[model samples]
Target: MNKVIEVQKLSISSSQGCIVEELSLSLEWGKPVTILGETGSGKSLLAQAIMGALPRGLEAKGEIRLLGKTVECKADIEELWGREVAMLPQEPWLSLDPIMPASKQISLVKRLVSLLNKPKSESIAIDSLARFGLEGSEGKVPSQLSGGMAQRLAYLCATSAGGRVLIADEPTKGLDSSRKQQLIQLLKEHSNKGALLTITHDVEVAKALGGEILVMKQGKVLETGCCESVLNAPKSEYARSLISARNLDHQRGDLLPNHKVLLELKGVEKSRGGKTLFSNVDLSLREGEVLGLVGDSGAGKSSLADVVLGLVQSDKGSVVHHQVLTRPKMLKLYQDPPASFCQSITLAKNLEDLCKLHQLDRKDIPRLMSELSLNSELLNRKPDSISGGELQRFAILRVLLMKPKVLVADEPTSRLDPIVAGSTIQLLLEQTSRINCAVVFISHDLELVKQVSHKVVKISDYVANHSSELSSPLVTV
Candidate 1:
């Protein structure tokens, strides 16, 4: 194997401070490497640096070699990007051109590698799509495709062209288990041709790749070794902590005796655009009880949540509530906290405005922030300046001030690392338990569901009673 990408004493710094400290890495042909870290650990920064795509105002100092070629400037390195190196961005759907169809995007990549004509490129695009189990989807734009499908398309664009070094950033972020496995296989196949580097928070992905693993934290590599040795027997305490935090063997106590029903849905039916989303669904949530909802993406779990939160009404059937429901009394924590906040304003302004609108006391804000282990100074920063996990913790603090009877959290930890996600879920449980708030937890991770939920329900089965149903099985824990 030959060295494809080599970095010696690489450092990246921004106006605030040094984001990535002195780091060194080497990836060789026919080998795959993964960098595992919590959010804001500078993993993605290194990826961008390797591809010469660093953010504006951030500069790199060190030596980077791609296939024995050295470049003096970032532009010089990027000149060789499309032909010698490729990157699969963090968000495939967003990275893809919204106006262009999938077929056109694939064709463009083919044209870049080989000056293929329109008809020939289109034919290759169709055949490539079929290889990824995405046959007949060439005409649809990224918006019309699901997250899994879009990720597959992104993989195609990166690898189908002639590139020797591939950098994948959280490639399996929103995929289900089956799609994730498929992605791992595809990565393996690509590694056979060239060097592969994966940046992710997913432990399973790191394990499946069966290659060298770098455990990073706060821009430094804490440990490095082969997959089996490093994960099963990590050398650093931080690495050990990360593995222990993802453990899902916690015991749940028995349900509260004579528990009061907080929220109930009976025979709920919802439809849109002459298509049935779900029908004949029933769910019950008792006070102090965590009810886990498991299903594949776009499986009507979010729609059911909308019905419960009164954001959308069911076409048929009913949503019954024993307790009085108000804007503050019932709150929903969104999947993406950045979307929830006004990006232009600082967190302090957002909090102040939210308090005024909800008639919440200003004094309670700092107290909840303390409980969630959030720094008060962070409140002065903009949402964009904070990490995703930290932003989610901020969102949790906002809802805690309301002292709601029930909390509906949708994919709260889907984008987070296992350790951070575990801690966040535990904090939510601890706080909500103190208030005896019923929780409706929706997620794709079944192991986490089993550890947290008092009772688990499969949305696939509930919707199967309708005319059209989910094509997957009812996974329960």
Candidate 2:
């Protein structure tokens, strides 16, 4: 096998700390390799380093060889990205231009190919869309498309312009099982023709791709081997934990101990533009129980969470709290952390304000911030000075301090790295358990839903059916 890419003693560091350190790996042409790690483990940074696109303030050392050619620095690696190596970002929405039509974005990619003297015909653009299950989305803007549709389109655009190596970062994060299967198949097809490297935390996805597995931690490689070898009998403890975490069977029959009803939605009916988003959607969340809302993008999942949070009004039906005819006591933690915080205000002031509004004492704010691993200095700094993960932690702390009866999280872990995502989930579960609060977790990651949620409710056929309520669970893929 011909080596398509190689990294030797690669190290990356930022002011926060080291991200990737002394990481060395080689990928062969016509093969698929998957990198697995928790969030903030430097998986994405490693990919960006290879693409010569590391963020500002990050420094790198060592060698990155592309097709046996050394790429020393950003300036030395001109025209290499998207030509020799293509990347599919973690957030599909961020990769797309919201105002531009999806088709135009594909056309732009085609034009870029042309500039490289490898022009693809206009028909290729449409054909690519069809291949990715986005056939009729040509005229639609990014916002108009569902999350799954946008993800598919982004994959199509990235893969359309041919490259020797493709780097896909959490490509299946927000997709349904069916779409995930499609993406896996597409990745297999790509790997059969060229080299492919997927950075993901999902073990099932990694196994399906059937490639060499690299398990990373804190910016270092812990284990590397065949998928079955590493997954079934991992040499490292971290690898063992990761593989164990992905097995859903271990979670079977695990129900919340306290099943007291906290929030109930009876015959909920919501509509938009005269079209029913969901009707007669019945759900009851109990103390210590997590209700997961799973569906493809635009499947009324987020809207349901919004309705629970009082951010959106339902067309009909009433929400009952603790068997009383009362509005839901919901607190929402947005996916984007910065959006939830006041930009100009210091972090301390924001937390103080939140504490004041909720009647929380000022002294408790510092302790809560520390529990979330936020520095006290951050309290004095503005939101602009903090990173996304830091801001998210702060937002979570604010919610924790408020101590709402019901928590509605809107894709809270989507933007985080795998380790960070897992940690955040654990924190939320722990806090909810301590407070005996019912949680409605809205997410695109099926693995996560299966893990944290006591009952899974998928948004299909316009009805919310609990896991126990159904005679047989429907596996869409």
lDDT of 1 at 398: 80
| Highest-lDDT candidate | 1
What is the model-wide C-alpha lDDT for candidate 1?
A: 0.77
Best by TM-score: 1
Candidate 1 TM-score over all chains jointly:
0.82
Error of 1 at 466 (Å): 6.4
Residue-level lDDT of model 1, residues 14-117, one tens digit each, is 77788899989999888799998876678877887887777667889999887777644667676566567888876564468877888888899888676788
Lowest-scoring 10 consecutive residues by lDDT in candidate 2?
A: 468-477
Model 2 agreement with the true structure over 1-477: per-residue lDDT tens digits: 388889999998877666678878888976789998755567877887887778777888998987777876667666766677778976665578878888778878778764532345456777777766676667788766655677788887787668767999888766777778888988888888888999887778899998799998766899999988998899998888777763333232234555577667777778654447777767777776677777776577877887776677787777776744233246887654555788778887887777666678677677776766666866767875554456678878878777667887767766555545666667777877777777788887776676777777777756433232222353210
Which residue runs of candidate 1 sit more than 4 Å off their true CA positions?
Answer: 67-74, 80-83, 92-164, 249-259, 271-277, 312-315, 327-329, 361-381, 466-477
Q: Tell me, what's the RMSD of every candidate?
A: 4.2, 5.3
